[model samples]
Target: MSKRILILTTIISLVFGLAFSGIIFAADDSYWQDHKEVLDELQSDGKPPTVIPVELIPQEDEATTALRERLNEIIDEYAPRIIEMSDWLYHNPESGYYEYNSSKMLGGELEKQGFEVTYGVEGLDEGYNSVIEERFDAAGLPTAVIAKYKGKTEHPVICFVFEADALRAPTREKGAFHGCQHNMQGPTAVGAAVSFAKLLEEKNIPGSVWAVLTPAEEIPPPDKSAMAKAGVFDGVDIAFFSHGFGPTSKRNEAGLGNCCYLIDAALYDFHGKTAHGSRAWKGADSLDAARLFLTAIDMLREHSEPEFRMMSAITKTGNAPNVVDDYVQIDHWNRNTDPAGQAALQHKAEQIDQIARGVAMAAFNEVDIRHYAYYYNGIEYGWLNALMWEYVHEYGDPEAISEELGKPSGWAECGYPSVNFPGIHVKPAIAGTPEVAGHSDENADLTISEKGHRALVQTAKIEGAMALRLVLDPKLLATVKEEQARWQEYGLEKGLITEDMIRK
Candidate 1:
């Protein structure tokens, strides 16, 4: 570990009173096992494991308290509209990159609240555009929305990034549906943005607010990563994101760490000559190359570490079995929990690529490879995450709030943006909500329910309070930025991020 990381770990140990074990790199499967043990230990000792000691977290002053009260009132007044927006999205679901009606409604709501709205973003690379056209038969992301509300000043541009795209049904004929409750994300963000902007105007605060309506959380190429590369998040000092609420009594805790697996995705195309199946020896068989490549990937698992994962699909191949396949396209994704593991994952990916080449050579076939997307783990700030968690518990439904904190989130949408500025993914629990598997019809149904409505309202208040505090207290924002700088440096040292990413 670097000196800075050791110092930060020492601070974390002092503040949270827990050993800081691999804060950035300890998120593999075994990490979860250890996390469960900690929870069990806390339960046995009759202490809240997820809660940070109150004295360690920053306290709200009278002015901050008054502002939060007013922010809550603003969001409360907009509660009915917020619920309606969420319900509307639930009823009219659209797939990724095709969220026309969804974006219109969300952007319209922002415009009604005095934000300047833009429909589509520029700067998506041509390679991504070509891929989208080939795969989804779409030209560009026409549904992405960027709405800005300027207060007395533009410094400290606080952004609320949210998604509105639904999952594509099992088949295209069935169309799209909100199996992941993405319908709730847009409204939750809008409610926060509108209320925060209103608060800014009402109190003459000097800051800016942005509501970024990102599409296609369930599909790739990831829209957020593409947008970040295109400079969509430029000049934003901080960002906030939210997801669907979980079951009741679930503690929502925040900490400095990455969530979900870092992903590297690519598509491989093999080209060969066609011939009759009976005379297959007379022609190169692309299908044989693709099959060999997949077999090699399967064999790779035996040598891969427990944290590594690989998924692939044959997206395209010749139709008739009577004839040798002339072309085959395989889409593949490799994943790992630790960002530092990316280098090893890349080495593995190169091995897979070589396997494809070797198979293609054996089959007398040519190959084309396109590395389309890279999703890195978000660099989380401990202070910001803890503060957001505190606000969620403070404004959340009492019955939904767990006496103990839940496991720290290991994934977020702001992975790309985290390198540039500070951000948090706010997770608030809903009361009386039954836990259902994500990306299911049952989970989708919860978005329009009474529990969902309360969650949406509470989340808005929570995010509003968090943003309000940042705007009200400059020192707090500075502290957050300082912490973010240290984490970014640590990420670089760990090889989780590159210098080019920071420059971008």
Candidate 2:
């Protein structure tokens, strides 16, 4: 074995041996005990078995290996701060487009780490600005935070995207809650970015690190998509995102493919003249139009492809039963797996718009439809996915480790940016954690638990290692860029992306 591989083996053996003996960092003892086969396999080969095809994996040189070690050390050094930040976000939850304090806290931490922090995106289109003003009573996205740390060179800029918005909790006493565990994302990305930045400064590496804190993930009008359109991701070469703990205890895998469905969202407003309850026939009822619109949309389900989905919510209705309703507003979301299904999604959206209009006309109400958001499905890289999977298996909770490799699952955030550049979302399993569904108080509580702390550190280590590899290996970076370009072409050919999505 080479010296680097030998060193890696020794280190793995030492860490596992300590855990086995009930010495240090033994949060999941039963898991370590059950995974002795994995340890034996690593000890015999000095390298972890390939999760992806061996050819697709990048080989690390001595220099790159050393830099990776330093990166992990930096992440370790910042683990306390990382956990603290996550906990703070958990306690102080804020909803989308209103995460002012969350932004300040996360951005403040980055600023303390010597990053140049900027708040909010400039030059957003009038429509987006109007939405912001109408929704949150803010002029622009006041909570959007962008922090940059440039090294000796600007090429190969690495970006980290973070979400800090909490889900609205109408039932609970708190108006907003970190049920989705977005509280973990900002700290995780910040931890990784700050560590990578430190490595670049110390090693005098030529690159740039950007940590973009986007708000309103759980709500409509996806912030990353808006940010992408506003040129926030213009110069970013590659990006990385991290989320809360996984739902499975088995090893999670990553591969080439899209992660989520494409979502097209719109708001429909039905307007009519109000009339007294005793003489309701004297005026048209907007509520009737809204109900008809919803029923018509439901009728489309049978005609839609099995993968297509629609969700609608009535945000406004009649104020009193005694008076005819003058106005009704419905927010609708249409979704489908993309590239192959983009046309179907577009058709369905148009049909839904037509249904709204038809329903309004039948009810003698005027309907206004506003297209608010479109979340495209983004691409993933097998090489990066494999790299992150390897780190996840290495440092992740053994109980959560799955022996099976995952298929290509595309990223959801910054789908537009994913087409423009290469990116991956790192989702390492929290150690000794049980299966927990997202957008729950249980998941949010786990963000501050022992498993959550361990996962935070592991995620940062994985992200820093991946970023270091990209920084140290120019050939790998080039290969990634080429792969992205090919995927972009495939997207255009497959009707997954339009010519307009291609950045100049």
Candidate 3:
């Protein structure tokens, strides 16, 4: 009986040991899976974890704790005002760059906080770029504005971006309403900034903190490329940004880096002369070319990728429906997994133009194709996001975030920034805090729930961590790129690739 008991005990011990071993092994595998390509990053930095003084990492210190309390107090104090603003903004959902009132109110709040506010700054045309920067991305529109926080630290500068854009109806109305919850990003970020600024001033924290209020995120022609051309990132070592989402979504999701694809692109414009119906033969039939162009595009649409997307605007079809129409121009925008795929689809545009040319020739007219507003996607920075997301899980309300969507563990997809950036770590993010079936149609309270406040607290903590991470160890920047390279290698092993990547 004693021998039998020993045997059972030994078997139980073996089972327990195996499970423990598996847990430890799994952790290494997870870390290795992400940092494998960056074996160099690990190998090069032979510093032992114990010796590394990451203690100075800006976190929820007593100062932060005190600041948060004060900030919460202020939020409570200003809850009424925020409710008024949120309700008004909620009722009036402006699409993309038309957020005039939203922008104006935000600018006013910042100015009241002692920020030398500027309206319509960094805007491409009237797009808007409000800079509280001791420095701007540049002395121009379409730039990031960083508010400098005075501080003493080994770290120098860090940025917190406030995205003041939203998804809206095509109608150019102020009350279009916030569909994607981009309206939350600005206030959450600014709220954090206010706390950080107050903390810095009250406690004399040493380091530069910038509350960068950026605009024009969702416009059809995002102009990110144009903004890039404008050297928006010339001097910046790191870029940190975030958007809002509905609760129970993938909030702290990381791994795979974010993958996106472009599906198709084309450009077709036709020109012809007009004449009386009786004298039709005497005039060029612009209507005929337009009709042919539409038919060709429609035919090609049938063969498009199952999950593909396409959109184009008839910028100019004709001055009037009468007179047979003199000239017409249609702007084209297309997407695909990669430019090569986009190119293959765009080749079909040649077929379209060939048909248009033939029709124009027969009609004694002309054809011109001008392409504009082309786009490529983007990926989130790896180490940067990993740290931000991981830190959030560590500090944020466990009950606030959900685990349903996005990558549960691992990195974002290697390629596809356009789509990936928006969805990376998408699960835990809250659209408006409540687990409502539909999106928020919030009033003055703008659906600001307790969960919403929790989300804001988490966001503030994440931003603070990112800022501290960037400033404290500038090397973290390179670590981020290395993480991306690892993501790319994993994607290659899995036959993954990014589409429409505009080469720098």
Candidate 4:
């Protein structure tokens, strides 16, 4: 072998495994050849996986049938008020931590229904809260409003979560709006909780219901996972999180098979000394250090897995082009679909802290790095998902929802609550055409349209019926808990979640 080739081979063997390094050296040419061979073989003999038929099985018990009838009546009576509340929220949008009015409206509605209310829960970044402070003339700290309905006995504590904050839609009215359809979430949750609460009262059901109003779901990087650990889910038997679907002309499908992405955000700050442009040698340049760090990130991307993602923005630098920059900051957000994948990518990102130091050392500067956010992907429980599918089928036609304009909804940050408390992450379509995108002007308009109001009422009925079933059926609850236990064991073995990671 040539001397240069031998050295390159040695380095590859030393630094990376043969499989990964082999791809680096030979896959570009060999991949297509392998791809063609696989394709030819598949064409000759491969068969697709078998598809299962969807059955619309109804709950046939006499008591269950009676319960369903009552739930329908409750939804019909209360949906109009719930729809009005959603319309009000759409017109008056608030962003993230500054959702004071939005929070108040949701909390007040529950309070009127005889729920005890509490405010201000923790687990969000200080910087995010600072925006609310500046804009609202208030402290703008991270907050979650909780409402509790105490039945005869609190044996089973069921919780429902609602996301109330709107998105930061730049150039829109008030610089914020319900582009994400969060306005639908609060009203829907409240409607469902109130309906379920009434049923418990009339039947003297011996269990409790909690309405947890969570904010800032659309604005991430600093996720609200810690809030559950902070006691919001204390004594909770199960928790449910539901949201509006993305834009799809077809009706949204009921699914728990979809895996969400693990996400995190980090910041790096480099410090140096300022100097005149003419006397550049007199001081170090933080901007040079920052640029070098970003270049290293670009190089790392080439070896990264196809599913791993990294996005960054340079936040600040020197004031003038002529002067050496004394300070520089770069924000990085990354995501991965699986636990093992997330671990590897996070390790690689953490290495950038050392890389920042190395680059700053070369540039005669100092560096500081902080990992500001961490969120795990949602866990799926087969029994919980099956239950949601049953409710979706019972309340409305699953085929109709799928064929209509609602997007097929998947998991989001609600996994935090799901992990700590076993539940389904529901996506009910409230408004918007397939052409309307989320976090946009058209989506905001959809929230106030007549179709939007109709859809919101239907969402309430579905979620309310589901919540009431869990409250009334002990056998069903047992089945769900068993499924969750099995899923937890699998997650631990696969590194999807850790014992320490779950809230006690």
Among these predicted structures, which one has the highest lDDT? 1
The candidate maximizing TM-score is 1
Question: TM-score for each prediction?
Answer: 0.84, 0.82, 0.65, 0.78
Q: Write the per-residue lDDT of candidate 4 for residues 54-92, one digit (tens) a residue.
A: 221125478866886887798789988898899999889
Computed on alpha carbons, the lDDT of every model, listed in order, comes to: 0.75, 0.75, 0.47, 0.64
**Predicted candidate 4: what Cα RMSD to the true structure?**
13.5
Which model, 3 or 4, shows the larger lDDT?
4
Off by over 4 Å in 2: 1-58, 247-260, 275-284, 321-323, 337-339, 397-399, 429-431
Which ranges of candidate 3 are over 4 A from the true structure?
A: 1-88, 114-157, 165-175, 197-207, 212-218, 249-269, 302-307, 310-315, 319-322, 331-364, 403-434, 437-446, 484-504
Using lDDT as the yardstick, the better of models 2 and 4 is 2
What's the C-alpha lDDT at position 320 in model 4?
93
lDDT at residue 45 of model 4 (Cα atoms): 21
TM-score, predicted candidate 3 vs. hidden true structure: 0.65
Which of the predicted structures, 1 or 2, would earn the higher TM-score when compared with the native?
1
Model 1 lDDT tens row, 84-129: 9999999999988888899999999999989999987787877877
Q: Over the stretch 136-180, how does candidate 3's per-residue lDDT look in tens digits?
A: 232243233434443454123344555555565545553455665
Worst 10 residues of 2 by lDDT: 24-33
**Prediction 2 TM-score vs. true:** 0.82
